[model samples]
Target: MIITEPKPFEDILEMLADVDEVSIIGCGRCAAASLTGGEKQVLQMADKLRAHGKTIVAEIVSDPAICYLPRSKEVIERLPKNGAVLVLACGAGAQSILEVNPELLIFPGTNSRFLGMTAQVGEYHEKCTLCGDCLLHLTGGICPLTRCPKNVLNGPCGDCVDGKCGISSSPFIKEEIDCVWALIYDRLKKIGKTEILSQTLPSRNWAAKTYKPQSIELSEEEIKQRGR
Candidate 1:
């Protein structure tokens, strides 16, 4: 899931400061799962905006999650196109709204954190960075590229200070990150696959790290044939 966190209300208010009539859009998928931009949050936001003296023209928790282009487009088409729109979803969903309505004033209400998984009700773990490379099989099902702060591929950096990652700051590594290479080593040794680590991984293809647009196109005959 694309994990997200709610932006501060003050920031949201500032974004909508000049606008009178506001339309709110929420995601029913990842944002809802993360407890940031779900239906309940949308209503709460509406109430808060109204209290601050902003006219609410619409509040919608998109059933199709606001990122699914076609369905979200259909939903957005029916809303009153006025003033500004506050989207409580990930960056992708917010952009999707703009793609559907290019002229509408749209603002993000949440911050896209990472592509991760839910560990509990309020806990999320970063699983992947979408690095466009897969070496999990060699690393015993762990992705060192993302888990390791240094993105070490083949082996440990040999500079870990007591098995903790080297980065810690407000915008970077927040918590005491365990050395992912150490984890990989332990996992490989435990599984009797330590030999795999000896084989060094080639340099990552930096070109593959870009966002490549994709689409699915099927001919009428192909669709009809599949119906059988």
Candidate 2:
């Protein structure tokens, strides 16, 4: 799921400095799971905005405001003509609403964090880095691109001390973080695929990550050619 965290209240207030009438937009999917843009958060934001002397025009909860253009339009229809929008969803969600109505001033109330998996409530673990090249088949399903601090693909950095990553820049990984390569090594050993490690990985093609977005779409003719 997409992970998002609410921006600091002070920053949100600062964004609203120019707008007096506000419409709040919340998310029912990713941002809801992160507790940053759920129904409760929307109401809380409304109350706070009211307290701050802003007229609340309207509020709507969209599951994935990013993917649903018509629903975003419906949400916008509830707002007054002069109201500005304060989006409590992730960056994508806020942008979705803006795309629907470019004339409306929109402010993001949350920061889009990462593509992550929801663990226990209030806890999210980063999974895919969208590196474009997937090596999970060779790495026992563990993502070296995301799990490794160095994003190493060939092998371990040779900095493992007792199977802990030597990268200590992350303050959250107190003491030591488990070495992703070591875990891959152990899992490969158990599965009798240790030989897979012997093969050299191709050098990464970073153009996919830096340039134009890639899409997988089949044309109508191509689909018909398949005889489906």
Candidate 3:
């Protein structure tokens, strides 16, 4: 799941300052799960805007999600072209809306946190970086790229002490985190798969981390075959 947090209301107000009329879009998936862009949140935001003297031209909580281009297009078509749009979803959903109509004025209502795994209701943990590479099998399912403070692939850095990672310069990982390589070693040892750690992995393909837009066109026969 993608984790998101609502942008500060003051910041939102600043973004919408120039606009007198606005349309709001919510997500029924991740944003809903995070309580950042659900129906309730959308309604609440609309009320806040109205109280602030802005006219609400449209409000919608998109089913599935606005990240789905088809749904974004559908929602965008229903909205008035005269008003600016405030998307209460992840950056992907907001971008999808822009893809549907580049001319539409779009504003993000939530700041994306990370791609995460849900621990429980209202709880999430970062698990993947979507690095476009897979080394989990060799590392016993722990992702060093995501979990390790330094993103060390081979093993813990020299600064590591005990089972904890070294302090990182990154603001996000400033606190000493548990060393993912140590966790991988312990997990592999417990399962009698320690030999897997002996082989050194090649340098990661950093280029793979960049996002590249994709398009696939299938013939009618190809599309029909996929259904089977």
Model number with the top TM-score: 2
Candidate 3 local lDDT, 68-117, one digit each (tens): 77545786677776459999999999888877777789999999999997
Residue 53 displacement (Å), model 1: 0.4
How much lDDT does candidate 1 score? Answer: 0.85
For candidate 3, the 10 contiguous residues with the lowest summed lDDT are 207-216
Clashes of each: 0, 0, 0
Shift of residue 17 alpha carbon in model 3, Å: 1.0
Better of 2 and 3 by lDDT: 3
Write the residue-wise lDDT of candidate 1 on 30-137 in tens digits.
999999988899999999999999999899988787889767789877557545889899999998888887877879999999999999878998999887667789
Off by over 4 Å in 3: 168-176, 210-228
In angstroms, give how far residue 180 of model 2 lies from its true place. 0.8
How well is each residue in 61-164 modelled by candidate 2, as lDDT tens digits?
77645546655567655555545888887777877776677777888999989999999889998999888888799998888889887888876888877888
RMSD vs true structure, all candidates: 3.1, 2.7, 2.6
Cα deviation of 153, candidate 2, in Å: 0.5
Report RMSD for candidate 2: 2.7
- Candidate 2 — worst ten consecutive residues by lDDT sum? 74-83
